[model samples]
Target: MEILKVKHLRKTYHTKKHEILAVEDFSFNLKQGEFVAIVGPSGCGKSTILSILCGLDKPSSGTIEINNNLKFGYMLQGDNLFEWRTIYKNCLIGLELENKLTKENLDYVNHLLDTYGLKDFKKAYPNNLSGGMRQRVSLIRTLATKPDILFLDEPFSALDYQTRLAVSDDVYKIIKKEKKSAIMVTHDLSEAISMADRVIVMSPRPSTIKNIYEIKLTGKSTPIQNRKAKEFADYYDKIWKDIDYHV
Candidate 1:
């Protein structure tokens, strides 16, 4: 089933100097349970598309139909955790704000906390945890809202190389285990190749769908392991060339 659809989407920013066309004729259909990655050159409007989908921004022209009744939860480039709140409190902040707190909801939150290795650190502050743990908490907080779709905007970009790889694998597993659909905007070609079932390539400024590549691989592996697959380099090389053309 189609969980999300974007038809002829366009977004333009009006400025004193000129009207910048950030996104143009963008369209795609996302399947239920699909993890799709969109990659492009920097300043190419990848985040614009994510922002519009998450309802943080509006597209100047187009149609977006999200099939589910639940709202989306967005994760930005950084953890965005509250310094004042404890880790557990930060995770439950969404429920408290929505006035949706309940015993059942709290129980569910506790279950996620324990399942995702945050149980011991529940009382700790965000500042005490490592970057990866903070990101995990950010995701758990997003998940606490019971969102039907999740929008991730380069959530792993700020991490160190080794931590990024491990965290990417962990996040991938968590999203899949939770049975959620995600749209991730990233510039890392290997990341796009590793975690996505389909990789959407965008052109430079005034971005549009350049192409979409289907990835076929077997077995479960970390992003690093996935990168080591025999066909990995071939896919990498092709996407590298495709985006290199625009750069």
Candidate 2:
């Protein structure tokens, strides 16, 4: 079933100098349980699209029709965990914001930490954990809200190359295990291919969908494992070409 629908989405920024069009004629639909990645060049308004979808910004013209019953969770480029707060406390922030910090919700958050191997470090501060572990905590914090759809905006960009790879796998596993639908905005072609079921390629400047590829790898595997698939290189090359052509 269609969980989200965006039609003719357009965003314009008006400054004293002139009007700037960030997104134009953009439209897409997300299915339940699907992981979709949006990829484009640096100034392609990828992040703007995400902000509009998640209600951080409004579209100038067009419509976004989401399942009214669904909730949203956003994970940004940085982990954004509080330095002074313990991992457990950080994870509870979301639930607290939504006023859903009941016993049942707390139990679910604890279960997520335990299932993801962060149970032992619940009392530890974010600084005490490795980069990957901290990102896991950030993800867990988002999940604690029990959102129906997740919006990931370059969530691993701050990590080193190796840690980014490992953490992507960790995140992919958690999302799949929780059966959540996600839309990720990324610049890395390989990362997009590894983690997404479909990749939406956008054009530069006033961005719109240039191409969409349905990723079909050989096996059920983690993001890192998917990177090793035979079709991985092909998908990478194709996406690279598409972005390259647009730029």
Candidate 3:
């Protein structure tokens, strides 16, 4: 089912001297359980599109239609966990702020921590965890809200290359296992191809859709395994060329 639809989306910014257009003629649809990734050059407004979709900011033009009763979860660039709080408490913070710290919700959070290998460290602070473990905790925090559609903005950008690979695969599995639809914005073409069901390429600056590719791997599985697919490199090259990086 189509859970979200965006039509002719445009966003502009105002300054003392002039107006700047951040996005231009953007449109896309996100279906249930679909993993979509948006990639473009730096400052191409990829993150801007995410902010608009998640209602953090308003678009200057166009409309976004979402299925009724759908809630959103966001995982930003860094893990953004507090050093002072235990991992379990960090996960519950969202529910606490939303006034949803009920018994049922508490049980769900515990289940996520246990299921995702964080049960042993629930009482540990964020500073003691490895980078990958920290990212998992961050994901659990986002999932704690029980959101239907999750928006990820450069979610693995802060990690080192090896950790980035492992964490991305882990995250891909977590999102799929939870059966949540996701729209991720990243500059890494390989990451986008390996992690997404579909990859949308955007133009630089005043962003617009340049191309969208439906990824098909021979034995499509985890993001890491997907890297070895026969068609992966071809898709990467095509997307690399389609991106307007030089402009």
Candidate 4:
């Protein structure tokens, strides 16, 4: 079943000097439990599409239809964890805001932390945790809200090379295990191919769908493992050519 649909979406920014058209005539549909990645050049309005989808920004013109029963969780580039709040408290913040801090929900949160190997660091401060651990906490916090769809905006951009790889695998597993649908906006072609079931390629300024690639690899594997799949290089080269043509 389709969980989200965006049609003829457009966004233009009007400044005193000139008008900047970011995205134009963009449309796509996301199926339940599918992981989709949007990739484009730096100024191609990839992030703009994400913001509009999550209701952070309104499109200048278009239609966005979301399943009435679905809830959204957005994870920004940074973990954005509160320095003052303990790891446990940070995870609880979302539930608290949504008025879902009931015993059942708390138990669910605990289960996520335990399943993800963060149970031992619940009382630790954000600074005390490593970059990868902090990102896991951020994912846990997002999951705490029980969202049917997740929006990840360069989620692992802030992490170092090694940590990013590890965290990407960690995040991929968590989302799959939880059986949630996700739309991720990322610039890294390899990362996109590794984590997404399908990659939506966009054009340059005033972006639109250039092409969509269905990533099919044999066997079930984590994102990191996907990188080592036999088809990985082919997908990478194809996606690179698409983005390179736009550039």
TM-score of each: 0.96, 0.97, 0.98, 0.97
Root-mean-square deviation of Cα positions for candidate 3 versus the true structure, in angstroms = 1.1
Q: Clashes in model 4: which pairs? A: none
Model 1, range 1-247, lDDT digits (tens) per residue? Answer: 9988899999999999999999988999999999899999889999999999889999999999988575798899989899989999999999999998999999988999999999999999999999999999999999998987889999999899899999999999999899999999987899989999899999999999888999876663666678878888888998898898542
Output the better candidate (3/4) by lDDT: 3
Look at candidate 2 and tell me the lDDT of residue 160: 95
TM-score-best of 3 and 4: 3
lDDT of 3 by residue, 182-234 (tens): 99999899999999999999988888899999999999999999999999999
Model 1 collision count: 0
Residue 245, model 1: lDDT of 53
Clashes of each: 0, 0, 0, 0
If ranked by lDDT, best first, what sequence of candidates would result?
A: 3, 2, 4, 1
Who wins the lDDT comparison?
Answer: 3
TM-score between model 4 and native: 0.97
lDDT of 3 at 30: 95
- Show where candidate 1 strays beyond 4 Å: 220-222, 245-247
Model 3: lDDT of residue 147: 98
User: Residue 4 deviation, candidate 3, in Å?
Assistant: 0.3
In model 1, residue pairs whose N, Cα or C atoms come closer than 3 Å (at least 3 residues apart or on different chains), thus clashing, are none
